[model samples]
Target: MAIVARGQADRGPPRDRCGDPDLDDARDCRRDRRAVVLPRGVARRRQAVDHRRRVAGRRGADAARRAGDGEPAQGAHPDGRAVRRRERHLLHRDGGQPGHAADHRDRRHPRRDPRRAGHGHPGPARALVGRCRHRGPRGASRMTADDLVWILPLIPAVAALAMLAARGRATLVWLDLLASLGVLTLALVIAGEVPSRPIAAGPLRADSLAIPFLLLIGFLAVATSIYSNGWVRHEVAHGGMKASSLRYYHALVQAFIATMLVTVLADNLGILWTAMEGTTITSAVLVGFHGDRRGLEAAWKYIIVTTIGISFGLFGTILIYAAAAHAHGAISDAMSWSEINTIASRLDPGIVRIGFIFVMVGYGTKAGLAPMHMWLPDAHSQAPTPVSALLSGAS
Candidate 1:
């Protein structure tokens, strides 16, 4: 490096000519800065705008006058204020995108030329160039209907996990309330989104049939969570409900809600049956949580009957799977209800009819349908108030 005498200590950093009042004209500054320092794409757009002005000049004063009227109307918008008084308008409200933008794009792909009729995109507020670029806040993304399908069940499942770290009974109750409300919020969101467009996220999906049950689960969960706050405090005060067991009860309730959500959202027949079985296990534990002889007896009967019915359902599922596989070949998509329904006529009729009977018995038992309806009353009556409400609303 060459040594040189330093400038005066008070001298500030060098300013470009754009900052100088005497030398800077807004139009000239933009043109120079745009050509030399602007990115390649923006420079191309500027060149396109200049070409438009040159063509307008050739069209006589009337064309130029008409073009100027369409530009924005604020001093901050350089193209607006400077056009009539200082210089010709060189930009549009749409961040300087010319009327021939589609034409320009078509020139690059000779075979395709399509013009879009749309509302003019507003320009940036502070920056005098470029299109409006609105992005979601940092570290967040748009949550779609498809995302909510899986997220709904996960909210309560996560709360169940969170319960393990909780200390006080009040904290557990509040956690339950938040989780239930969260599930309700997701259900409402899914309800809004699914009606307009069906959402399918791999193993989980939402359709017309599932929405009502999901909403009921959500509503009942929220209502039960709120009601349990007072009811649980009373049980601890008057009844023999151990203060220590409240956390587990709340956790099991969330897990119960999770199973219900999983059952509703499952797209596969196998997953549905599995989720139903999961519901039985969670609810059985909750049914016996009271630690009384009657409660224990109710829980045992509930599990035995539901387990037997579900086993029939499982056999039915396997038979249906076999039918689907024989029709479509042994493939992974055989387990999906939608796929099975698409080829329903091709399945072995005798095996399908038998499987249907087994499945009706299996799921019907849990649903409290006749002949398998023996366990419903005792289990519901023995379970805690919140669980009873859940069983009633979900069933």
Candidate 2:
């Protein structure tokens, strides 16, 4: 009985061993082994819990710091926000902030990011992104035919400054303007029945179908130019553009005029269509020149609508070519307006009607007819008064 009692005492807890009273001492030995292993497992689990608590506490402190600083709480990783905050905090700790120092040593020799501190760029990456977001439309203003008269000359002048240098610098602008005016005057003189070269032999075609249209365009261009000088001067006075932008404006205006004149004088449908499309591109920038919301919107609408209409005209021109091929086995004859009219009776009426529909619809949009005239009022109202005058008159 004494031996049994001693064994039972050595066994430790009964549940810890197999149900064998004789093997109670074995159970006690096993209990002793477990005591050694259990402490290591418990210590490891405690260490894990302690490590997790430390990490959780650090996250909470970082979150609190961000909240107190009025910064966005980016997650635990060191992202752009975190980096910016650290930089700002360092700057503050060094002395107030980076830009606050008047004659501070660091301020005198400021550290700058290469991207932000470029020759022209003077802001942070985020600031640059913001500026890009705020940037307005590409095409803001409507450039008229008269506007081109000034614009085309300036382009060569600017180019000459780089290319021709001494000689070009002396006379590029004046020469270009004079030459453009001379060409325009020659065209008009020829149209007015003044004696000139064989090229002028095409009768002022006075009573011709296109004569009235050509004369109208010419008169409008002249009137618009007179108005533009005053309007542009007013814009400069009102701070609408810098000197550089004004120079660009003047040059583009003349180029635009040249394109319109070409469109009017084009004896071939292909040439007419090409000139009209050129006019659209040149005028688009003028529409958005003001860099305002309304100006940008108007410019966008005008470009899209006119481009779509012109595409239809292009398709019709191709169809006309196809018709001419079918009728006379000649594509070049189809391009000539005079030939097309003369052969109109012999051509497929269906094809002619379709082509005419396209021409009218396409050119009519430019002509400011209803339905497609949605862009017209906005373009006219937002554009400078001179541009509006040309659009109303010449277009």
The candidate that wins on TM-score is: 1
Root-mean-square deviation of Cα positions for candidate 2 versus the true structure, in angstroms: 23.2
Per-model TM-score on C-alpha atoms: 0.66, 0.52
For 1-395, candidate 1 gives per-residue lDDT tens digits of 32232224343333566664544454554444432345567667877999999877766654454478555544323332223322123334335443333323332332332233212222222331343234466998777668889889999999999997898987998899999999999999888888787789998989988999989999999999999999999999997588888888888999999999999999998799989999999999999998899999999999999899999999999999999999988579899887898999999999999999999999998988988888888998988888898888767
| Per-residue accuracy of model 2 over 84-199 as CA lDDT, tens digit each | 33334444454454432222222222343334442223345332322332335788767433343333324433532332332322243444344345544544644554233222
Candidate 2 lowest-lDDT run of ten: 197-206
| Model 1 segments more than 4 A misplaced | 1-141
